[model samples]
Target chain A: MSNKKSSKVGGLNWAKLGTVAAEPATRACYDPTGVAITLEAKDEKASGGEGIVYTVPGKPGFLVKVYKRETLENPSKANAIRERIEAMCENRACQAMKGLAWPLMPVYGDASRKNLIGFAMRACKGMPFSSLFNGPASVKEKFPAWNRRQLAQTAVNFVKRVRLLAESNVLVNDFNPANFWVDEQCNVSFIDVDSFQIADRRGRPLVTHTYFASHTAPELLASPSALNRPRTVEHVAFSAALVAFQLLMCGYHPYSYQGVPDGGGCGSPDENLRAGRCPLGIGADCRLPDCWYKLWSQLTGKLKNAFITTFRNGHSAPAMRTPLGDLEFALNGLLITMAKDADPDRVSLNPCKVKSHEWIQTPAAPRSFMPRPAYPSRGFMRTPGFARPPYVPQQQYNPQGYGRFPTPRMGGTTSNFNPNLY
Target chain B: MNNNTNNNINNTLGNLDVMNPAPRCPVTILLDVSGSMSGQPISELNAAVAQFVRETQADEAASMSVELEIITFGSTADVVQPFTSMASVTPPAPFVAGGMTLMGAALSLAERDLAARRELYRAQGVSSYRPWIVLMTDGRPGDNWEPVAKRLRAEAERGKFMYIGVEIGNSADHATMCQILPTEPGPVKLQGLRFKQFFRWLSDSLKSVSASAVSDQDNIAYPSVASWADLA
Candidate 1:
């Protein structure tokens, strides 16, 4: 393919066009009410795989997300997006929700009003939700005073928004972490609202083909055809639970675990989900990292039970998944429990007994602690103090061969993490 | 007290260190800083590297997961930056082009570094996505590279990592790159020195890969390289 043609196939070229300093260009467009609105696209705010968000010169409270040229060029995709955005704009209940960046109006590209380009929504202010899942050091840098309580509250706020969307008959099919932004108050404002699966006036799905595999339920992952069809609240339950788990556990996927010798092969998150190999589930026989184990142990019994049930039983029985309301209740109770404890604002729910520096230094020390071999003469020195022992190719890839540590037993008694009957 | 209660207390006391863990995605960039790339080429390459870092850091998902390292080949392969998470990585010192291309040694270093990094991840019980090895060169290698090329080709075939080869400017030995990546699409030739566009595409691609679940990772359609590559 020619360079020009191939480049145009995707959406906007953010590199060539520049992200923050796009030249001001005036575009003639119309709003949802058929009012002709002239948008003086000022500065490029953000650009993603699908579209570019631009700030409007006169519109102080809103930003415009212009669909890539390729998206509008495709007749079917353009129509579907236009229909979904229009439906969302018309949904009073959806717009009433304070946290969603709901489409206020569809911006047509031309005077005919038939050409759909993008939509305008309220500009959201906050760091991406993904930032909350970073390492403790990074978390401290981004949100200095945030504690487990704040993290719990963030999860609660996210669940509430998801619940509100469900009530309004909208499903956030794509649960990408970058799509949600959380402010200092733990309020989550969801962007990419146009991609949400919406229901028509007749209660039919305006289906969307977008889902993150890590966030998707097992049933959906097993069936490729189901992705194109309308998703149910059951699917939402699984995703919501996964998000809540990650938020509370500092980004560790519930399915992510170290493989025991007798355990089924080590697999990726989706693979583990497909195999129903949750470390917290019964008969899973896997081990979580030391830190993750501590975090899991720190959760209150009720909250832990909720997660255990949702991941273990809900894997097979979709109906057994914890409801959003129940999760919210559990989280609020957790807050109450925290408030009763000393140092409620402490960074960790269960702070390490070790000194702060020692706790921070342990995980990374293992690599440096390993005995180093004498370096062979090479032309130049490797990056200072970062030299590695010579690489020897393994005959067979074995995850077990790496420095394996004993899986910490939840209560030091049982090997399994299965909670006793509640 | 019951055994379970005693065990719980013991376990808690035994493992007192708290760690915040996330899955990792490591990417090693091998760049040619041969004498032929001394002037504007080196300057543009430096700028592009910085831009790539800035762009990758901007995306929260990529910033959290993507671990970046850089290896520059001139007199000999030099580790400009060791593998570090994007959240903490700063742009490296400006590359000064000086000597013959040591692409073979550089490739070897990248391979070794990646293997070591993966071992570390496994030892730490950290789940990692498929690692990426990107090689960008503007001149032919001065040393023997046939053995390293064969090994890289085999590794790529084994799906150990994603290998991307970029031929920079007119002097790049595209045929040699083609041999190294025989099974995969041949090396892409850069359109002039549009390093910014190339790196941006790379940033976007990494973001997509890191954000995707394992089931859909192979199916991820990278953004068209047409913006910076000469496909024709």
Candidate 2:
């Protein structure tokens, strides 16, 4: 039991512990075409489980994603990744796409251009697509004054990009919303383009190892080798439809309802899809949040049918999923309708309505279908099973203010607070 | 529809509130605010907790899935904040530390609330990931904690929820903390006063958990805690 408060222990300074302070020794690197470039490690822009992204010092419009050392530990895997990126850079169609942060050049670990550590890509600017698919309050807070027309336009933009990728014989196997960014003007930019399954000029997939269960088709989820196989256009359609649906319906996952045939405890969204239970499907006895039901009802009949056909009929049959072109047309029609609306109040993707009962008539007790809990008021604490005593302010307490308290000084002692730890 | 019916619908819509429909991942934090944690410790803890909320809210997927609740035990255990969606959660008022360490009563209250929340999820057909209960304390328990600890350990063994014990400082009773936690991944001591780093790690872990596919839940690898924790 060491009661010593010293941040240093056994000649080790804990303040600098785990910090990657040592810069990479090799600064000069060559592109795939043997062009020499210098990389200055100023600061990391972002880091994730796979790699760290940094700005190319002289290249203002480009970002360099350096693979984490562990991610490229296997020689064979590293070769495969390099080859895939090289093929992508060489592809004319992939290079021509303006929406994607496509790999521009393969970056090497040294001047020999033998060790492919990462690649440089165009930098994308915008908030994550997931930000658009948030709760009403968050959406309103992030994009103030954004209406249904904007939502529809965002979906349309996403559809157009997906269609272009499909035309280029590429498949965005992973449909994670974080990988896509949407600007205020409803323009979408796709990131992580390196993870896409691209076909070579000979029509063979250069890279394929992706199956995100949440957005993947049920048939793919059932296959153990789904990751090794290239995703089809139909499969991509399902994912695209799901993303568009989330954007349009204000983040309601198509499979997020309760009360299916066997008491609705099917766990994850993937599991729900595997069980072929969907709230939008015909004869679905499930209970959705009232707002979801309202949003579903607010959608035009054709669009509703499209979603139903995709999530329900398309669950087992991939071909039944709505095509990206059809989805784009339907969204365009929606935007047109919104433009012709007489009242601005009704021009919201998330319509305010209380007619869920008319849509879903569950046999369960009506009380069970009540709206979800509201946000708790500020300063209202819920002390379960005990009466909260009246506030008796302690010493140095500020009742009227709520912010970071000024750091108090230690009398005749050195404090170990490091502001730059993160 | 008639004009009256349309007006009624409009009124209902006006009153109706929308919620994120993603699967729920409830995390309840049990903080010890005994007299021992008076000055710098409490301040660090407050700042760390506030940082954790901000980090979680910034993540799109985590904000939709994670529900946070906080329980503080001092003279008496009280739910300072109920289960709240990260999207809607406001940073709680700075906690004022004082009084005794009623660790047992707080654990009991946390267990009861978790069970109630699970029941609500089941009844509403809302799917949920494994819930998490984080018990953080600096001093020894002032009340009988053995019974609740035993039950909680048994529940943890049953895989109902994950119970993580964090020892705040050198004054924390490590032996008792170890006993309260499960066998594997036992109690970890906080490094110096790196509560901010610890909470950042926690926020990142919760984000991964919330984003994980159902099949990958068991294999979710948490980020390294060397920056914040002393496993030794």
Candidate 3:
């Protein structure tokens, strides 16, 4: 394998410390322009999925993505939806400048016809909210204490920004944690801007809702309504899920909340794990199963009336959920109440907990660990060090092969992901 | 029976005439993780995986339908991944580049995997083309590949599997690896660490397979794409 052109032809190979004549790790490069690229490996935060996170060579701290050279075969569907997103980014940047909305997405680049590649400012430097909130031993063990009042105010700030963007004709993904970045000052920035939309500027969504499957509201999943259906249902759900999760941190963790039934297999659970503190357990998967739907109905059985009759409960009518403006206001109000020298985390809220057998399985670690991005676990050039779990055997129904490794896009259920549809 | 229900669903998805459920190309990456392939080879192999992931992520057709699995032969020939969707497929666990290229065990693994995966397709009611197998290796098999090669040829002749051998590094003996496939366009060398490029060609070839309405041998496109242009 000593086919070296130079030591630093690309960037650092974590597997080998010195200048090794290693083969090119990736092959699907389509820079027909032959742009002189110099890949500089950045000191990435050691938490999230695996893969080599690189700042585009010439672009100067611009893009971060895993290349196609690895063995995992992921359909680059993002490239297709990205074209429309670039226009949205321009719209949002304009909005940010106009004081209409905050600019979260940055740029979109296409390499001729092969694939779409782009980058956003690393959304959050702190940690994935999922890891921080849920005590997943696979991720960080604890979240530092922040005053309830301060945290509530921060939540409101993000809500206000989201609401303003929604009013401007944008539908921020409520269920995707990978898209939301919680900064040092507690500022929330949304990445994956390709799916963003301009308020009232009409045409089908640049990014389809089916693509954002896991975070999909039961309403959208069950009914293929108007394209705008997801925007409405998801916006309200996002606000509630956020507030609900925040509530749990303060010790008054509600007993339960009403649940939404998903369309069968809407394929966006990574975001749920990345954004919503969702467990990657089988039941929590984006795929819809009759049993889990039944489980959900059982958990929130008492709140059936509120869910079906009242809009206050998001599960009420298929279309009715909390309004973005109301979410902004409630979060703001929650902030103010906590700011009154009282504990923000102490706010009272009713929980229609939908207890599931899945939650019972939580204390067990899911198959795969990437205390970092999904690609790097394979990229670290370390030994292929993993043994089958003593408890789980490999088979057709329960294949033990590659079950725990993050291979990035394998054949997933399309409750949300469809390369052509997206 | 449950099989009947599954067959109906399969028929609905791949409505091609022959209605073969097995993939037109059942590619197997016979990875050599023997002691001689330690450190760089093992790491390079992982990088190859990362590259393959990125390529397929862009391949629309293959990503949706192409079934993939990995079998590694070091001290033992282990089936790391069975035929699964690219969307859900996980990367094989990292290997320390230990043991011997138990080529025989690996081939046996591929033979069984192909037989079973094809059965799944038939039951699913999906239409598919003649299957293909890709054998990528870095060295001569410590376990003789002659019997496995003969068995692989039999499957190819029966319109079940197509085999291609790729030789990488000095540890690889092209003449020996070549015998594993049909005596057509001999085995290809992984020039200048081109594992990623070879996979690109492989995925692209599979994409063509997925897009085709027919599952016949003639319908599948391969040994053509620029990535595969190096085939000699």
Off by over 4 Å in 2: A1-29, A33-42, A260-266, A340-346, A354-422, B1-18, B58-64, B87-90, B122-127, B211-215
Give me the displacement of residue B174 in model 3, in angstroms: 10
Runs in model 3 lying further than 4 Å from the true structure: A1-157, A173-175, A192-194, A200-211, A218-230, A233-316, A324-422, B1-30, B34-100, B104-189, B195-232
Query: Fnat per model, in the order given?
Result: 0.29, 0.25, 0.00
User: All candidates' lDDT scores?
Assistant: 0.69, 0.70, 0.43
List of clashing residue pairs for candidate 2: none
Candidate 3: tens digits of C-alpha lDDT, residues A1-422: 22122112112111232222322433233232534334443433221121234455455534444322221234445543444434544563443432222333423233453444432333224433333222111121233334334345545555666655554456555344444545445665554443454332444444444333333443444444644443542444444444433322321111111122242111122222223323212222222122223222231111221122112223223223334444444455445534463322133221133222211111223223222211111121223356422222111111233353222343444454321110
Best by DockQ: 1
lDDT of 1 by residue, A178-267 (tens): 788888888888988887888876777898887887788888878889787677776777788898888887677888756734332255
- Model 1 stretches with alpha carbons more than 4 Å out: A1-27, A38-42, A260-266, A343-350, A353-422, B1-20, B219-221, B224-227
Backbone clash tally for model 3?
A: 64
DockQ-based ranking, best first?
1, 2, 3
Which TM-score value belongs to model 2?
A: 0.79
TM-score of each: 0.79, 0.79, 0.39
